[model samples]
Target: MENEISSKSTYRLLYRVKPFLAITFLQFGFAGMDVFSKVALNQGVSNYVLVVYRHAIATAVIAPFAVILDKKVRPKMTFSIFTKLMLLSLLEPVIDQNLYYFGLKYTTATFAAAMYNILPAITFLMACVFGLEKVTLKSIHSQAKVVGTVATVAGAMLMTLVKGPVIELIWTKGRNNQGVKGGGTNIHDSIKGSLMITVGCFSWACFIILQAITLKTYPAELSLTAWICLLGTAQGTIVALVMERGKTSVWSIHWDTKFLAALYSGIVCSGLAYYIQGVVMKDRGPVFVTAFNPLSMIIVAVMSSFILAEQMYLGRVIGAIVIVAGLYFVVWGKSKEYKSGSPSTDGQMVQDKQMTDTSSDSNENSTPEVITLNVSSRGGATRDEQINRQSDQLLV
Candidate 1:
C-alpha cells in the first residue's frame, strides 16, 4: 500500500512539473541550434542556403505526421489561406531567417539570442496597432504592457549602442585576446548585425500576427505547420538561387557541421519543438510557453561562452537583465489580462475552456481531437480574442 501510494505521489509530481521540464529542454535545444548554426556559418555555410535546407528538412520531417494525424479535421484550403501561407513563408522562413542568419554571422550567438527577447514587445505594439489588443489606461495590466514595451525597446537600444569592457569567464579568460579578435567586436559589424536582428524581430512579429489571422481559416496545427514548412522551402530556394547565383559550391553539403546544423535545427527546433509546445500549450496556456523564451537566451549565453569562447560585455549583460525584467512584466500583465473576466474576454475564455474540456474528453476516450474555430460563428469572436488565440498557436 505504501509503495503504491508513493508511486501515485511520484506520478502526480511528474505531472505537475512536466511542462517546466519540457520547456527547459526546449530552451537547451534552441541554445544548441544557435551554437551549431554559428559553427556552420563560420565553416562557410551560406545563410541563404542554410535557410532553404533547414525548411526543406523540416517539411520532410513534419509532413508525414501532418498527413497521417491531421487527415480527419484538416480544413479545406482556400485561395485566401494559400495566399496567407505564402506570405507566412516569405516573412519568417525567408526574410526573417536569412536576415537573422546574416545578423548571427556578424554578431555572437549570445547577442542574437538576447536581442530576440524584444519579440513580445514588438508583437504587443503590432497588436495594438491592429486593434487586436485593447489598452485601457485605467488598467494596471495595460499600463504594465505599455511600460514593459518601452523598457524592452530601451534595453535593445542600449545593447546596440553600448559596448563596454568584456567580462571574461573561466573559459574565455585566458583567451581574451583571441576572443576579441575572433568575436564580432567591430563597431560597424555590431551596428549592422543589431539592425538586421531588430528588423528580423519586426518581421517575426508580423509573422506571428498574420499567423493568428491565418489560423482562423486554417486551424489544423500540424497541417498548417507542414504547409508553412513546405511553402517556405520553395520560397527560400528561389531566394537562395537568386542570392547565391554564382556560388554553386555554397549549396554543397557534406558530413560536416553545416549539414548537422540544418539537420538538427529542422528536426529538433522546427519540427519537434512545434509538436511539444502545442501539447504543452493545450495543458497550460500560451503565456506559459512564452514565459520560458528567455531561458533560451540564458542558455545560449552560457553555452556560447563555454563552446565558442564568446566574450560577454557589461553593456550586454545589463541590457539582457533589463530585457528579461521587461519581459517578465509583460508576461505578468498578459496573465492578469487573461484572468480579468471582462464580458467579451470571459466569453472567449469560457468557449476556449469548453473546447479544452471537450478535447480532453475525446482524448480520454482514445479519439483523435483537433481544436478548430467554428467558421460559422467566427464573426462572433472579437479581434482581441482571435489575436489571443493566434498568439497561443503561433508562439509555439
Candidate 2:
C-alpha cells in the first residue's frame, strides 16, 4: 500500500488534490482486489467457490451497517423497492461477479481489468438513454464527457482486437510455477475470458446506471448496499446450488487463503466500495464514478507485471493511456459543462423578475393610453411621446 503511492506529490494530489479523490481511490481498490484474488487463485482455489464466500462475507460485512441505516436513515423498505433491489443484485452480484471470477479462471486478471475499461463508456450511454445523465456539446465539459466516453470504449475494443501479447505468466518464485504462459491461447483457443470480462463490465455498467435510479428512490446508501448484497447472496446460492451440482463442496467452509481472499473482497471491495461509490456518485454521477476503469486496469497491469512477473505489453500501456485520456475528456468536459450551465441561474432569475415588473407597469399604465395611442400617433403621442404628453398635461 505504501508502494501504491510512492510519490508525495501524487499522494497529496490524488488522495487530497482532486475533488473525486475518494472515488478514484475506490476504483483503484477494486482493481487491487482483483489482483489479490488472482494471486490467491494461483495458490489453488476454485474461483466460483471463492465468489460464493465473497457474497456471503460481503453480506455479513455490510449487514450491520445496513440494519442500522434501515432502522433509521434509509427509506422504508417497501416490497417494490426490495424487488428492484433483487433485480439489481441479479445484475451485479450474480452476473457481474460470476462472470468476473469465471473469466479470471480462464483469463489473466490484467486482461479482465483491461477489458473493464468499457464500463464508463457503457454506463454513460446507458445513463444518457435512461435520462439519468445529460450530455451536450455547447460546453467544453460536455465535449470532454463525450470524447472521454468514446476514448474509453475505443481503447477497450482496440485491446481486444489488436492481437497484442496475451501471454500466460507463471511466477517461478511461487510454489506452483506452471500457471504462467506467453500467449492468451486457451484450450478452446477463444478469448472466452476476455468475453466474460466484457460481460462483467457491461453488467456492472447497468448496475451503476440503475444505482443512480435507486438512489433517487431510496437515498439510504447503506441500506441499499446491504439489501443488494442480501439479494445477490440469494441469487448466487441458487446458481451455486445448480452449477456445483448437488455438491455441497462449494458451500463447505474452507477458512483458508481463499476465504481470506474472499473476506478482503467482501469487506473492502464490496462493502466499503459500495459505501464509497454511493457517496461519490451522489456528487459525481455514474459516468465519472465508473470512469476510473482505466485506473483499475493500470493497477492490475502494473501489479501483475512486477509483483507476479507477468509479461507486460507495449499495447497495454498505450491502450491504458488512450483510455485515461478519453476519461479525462469526458469527466472534465461533463463537469465543466455542468458548471457553465449553472452560473447564469441566479442572474437569470433576477433579470426575469425585473423584466416582469417593467412589463406589468407598462401594461397597467398603457391600457388607458391604448385607445388614445392611434389618435395620439395621428396627432397623439407615440409610445415614448405619450409619456411626455402625459407629463406635460399633468404639469399644466
Candidate 3:
C-alpha cells in the first residue's frame, strides 16, 4: 500500500515538472547542435555549404515521414500556402541561419548563445508592431512584459560592451588552446560577431511572428517543416555556388570532422529538432517554447569552458543573470495573461475545447492520450476544429 502511494506521488510530481524538464532537454539538444556546428565551421566548411548540406539532408530524412504521418490531415497545398512557406524558408534557414553561422565562426559558442537572448524581446516588439499582441499599461501583466523586454535588451548590451577580467576555470585553466578555434579573447571579432548575431535575432523574431500567422492558414506542422527544408536547401545551394565561385573544393567535404558535423546537425538539429519543436508548440505555445532559449546560453557557457577552454568573465556572469531574470519576468507575465482569460487566448481555448469535446463524444472508445494529443494544437487555425468535427475524419 505504501509503495503504491509513493508511486502515485512520484508520478504526480513528474507530471507537474514535465514541461520544464522537456524544454531544458530541448535546449541541451540545441547546445549540442551549436557545438558541432562550430567544429565544422572551424574546419573551414563554408557557412553556405553547411546550410545547404544540413537542410538538404533534413528534407530527405523528414519528407517521407511527414507525408506518411500527415496524409489524412494534410490539406491541399495552395499557391498561397506555398508562398508563405517560401517566405518562412527565406527568413530562417536562409538569411537567419547563414548570418548565425558566419557570426558563430567569428565568435565563441557562449557569446553566440548569449546573443540569442535578445530574440524574445525583439519578438514581443515585433508582435506589438504587427498588432498581433496588445500592450496595455493598465494591466500589470502587460506592464511586466514591457519591463522584461527592456531589461533583456539592456542585459544583452552589457554583455556586448563590458569585458571584465577573465574568470579562470579549475579544469581548463592551464590546458593547451591549440585546437580551440576562435575560443574567446577576440574582442574585435567578438564585437563584429555580436552585431551580426543581433541582426540574425531580429530576423528570427520576424520568423516567429510570421510563423504564428502562417499557422493560421496551414496547420500541418510536419508538412510545413518539410517544405521549408526543401526550399531552404534550394536557396542555400544557389548562394553557396555564387559565394564559392570556382572553388569547387569547398564542396568536397573530407570524411572527417566536417562530415560528422553535417551529419549530426542534419539529423539531430534540423530534422528531429523540428519535430520536437512542433510537438512542444502544440502542447504549450510558441512563446512558451521560445522562453526556454536562455537555458541554452548557460549550457553553452559551461560546455565551452570545459571543452573549448573558453574563459568566462564577471561581465558575462552579471549579464547572464540579468538576462535570465528578464526571461523569467516575461514568462511570468505571459502566464498571468494566459490565466486571466485574455480574449484572444480564451476564445482559442474555448473553441478548441468545444472541438475536443465533440470529438471525444464521437470517438468514445478512444484513449485519453489520443484526445490530449490531438487537442493540444489549440492555438492553431479553426480548420483544426473542422478536422475534429467528425471523429470518422482521422486526426493526425
Candidate 4:
C-alpha cells in the first residue's frame, strides 16, 4: 500500500510539472528550428517551400513507424476523424507556418521569441473561452495559474515594445556597396516582426487547445499525426506550386551546411521529434506537452548570442526573468491544487482497487459489500472523489 501511495504521489507530482517541461522543450526545439530555417530560407527557400519539403519528408519517415507497429495503435480507421485531423493540420502547420515565416521576414529571432512568451497565457484564455479548459480561482493552484499567465503576458509586452541599444556593423563593399551593411533589421521591423509572430503563436495556441478534443476521437496520435503532416504537406506543396513553380531554379538543390541543416530539421526535428511529442502527449496530456516552451527560449537566447551575435539587452533579460517567474507560479499552483483537491489515499489518487467478498450469492444478492475505485483529477476546486462502476466486484 505504501509503495502504491508513493508511486501515485510521484506520478501526481510529475503530472503537475508536465506543462512547464513541455513548454520549455518546445521553446528550445523551435529555437533550433528558427535559426536553422532562417539560414535555409535566406538561400532562396521560402518558409512555405521549406514546410512543404519538410512535411513530405517527415511523413515519409513516420510512415514506417506507423505501419510497423500498426497493432498497438487506436481509433481504428474512421473517416470523420481523419477529416478533423486534416483540418487541424491546415490550421497549425499551414497557416501557422505562413504567419511564422512571413513574420520572420520583418523580425529578428530574439524579438520573435520574446513576443512568443505570451503564448501560454493566450492558450489558457483561449482554452477556457472555448470550453476546452476549466479554470477556477477557488484553489491556490488555479489562482497561481492565473497570476503566472498575467505576468508572462506582461513580460512579452515589455520585450516587444522596448527598444534596445543598436550595434554598428562594418560590411565589406559588395561589388558596389550593396547587401546588408551598417544597420540591422531596424527597430520598426522588429516591432512588425514581433506582431506577426505573436499572431502565429496564438494560432499555435489554438491548435494546442484543439489537441485534447482531437485525441479523444483519434486515439492513435501517430496515425493522426501522419495524416496531419501529409495533409499539411499537400497544402504547402500546393502553395509552393502556385508561387514558386515558375522560379523552380530558386528551389534547386545545393549540398551544403544549409542542406544538412534542412535534412536534420526534416528528419529529426519535424519527423522524430513530432512523433515523440505525440507519444508523450498521450501519456502526459496537452498542457504537459506545451509547458516546455520556456526552455526553448533560453536555448534560443544562448544560441542567438553565439550564432547570430544578437545582444542580450536589458529588455530581453527582464522579459526572460518575468516569463520564468510566471512558469514557476503556474507549476506551483498546479502542484498545490493537485495535492489539496485531487483524490488521494493520504494525498495520492487511487489506482486499480478490487473489492472481493466471500459471502454466499444468496445473502449478497440484496446487500452491497465491496466496491471498486479509480481516480483522476478534473482540475476543479472541489475535492474530486470519483467512484466508478466495476465489472466483477463482489458485494458482502
- What tens digits encode model 1's per-residue C-alpha lDDT throughout 1-396? 576555655644564567778978988998999899988988778999998889899999999989999997688988989998889888988899899899998888888887777776677666557544667878888788677776776676666567699887877776642444226778788778889988997897787667655654565678877888889899999999999899889999999899999999888877777556555544433434545566677789888888888777888778778777876776677556654433322123324544765777786885433333222234565434544454444333
Model 1 residue runs over 4 Å out of place are 1-26, 176-182, 273-292, 340-396
225-266: candidate 2 lDDT, tens digit per residue: 887877777788778777887676555556576777888898
Tell me the tens digit of each residue's lDDT in model 4 across 1-396: 576555655654564456446545555667887677655655556677777877787788887777776546454667877777776787777887778777766665666666677777777777567654457668666788788878878777776676565333232112221132211257676666666787888888877667556765565666766777788888888888887768876566578646755676677666665666665544433444554566566677667665555655667677778878887787676556544544422121112112112244335584543322223455333322211111112210
* TM-score: the better of candidates 1 and 4: 1
Q: Write the per-residue lDDT of candidate 3 for residues 369-391, one digit (tens) a residue.
A: 33232222434533234323333
Return the top candidate by TM-score. Answer: 3
Show pairs that collide, candidate 3: none
Best by lDDT, which number? 3
Residue pairs that clash (backbone atoms under 3 angstroms), model 1: none
Worst 10 residues of 4 by lDDT: 387-396
Q: Is candidate 1 or candidate 3 better by TM-score?
A: 3
lDDT of 3 at 184: 48
* Candidate with more favorable, higher lDDT: 1 or 3: 3
Error of 4 at 338 (Å): 3.9
Error of 1 at 131 (Å): 3.7
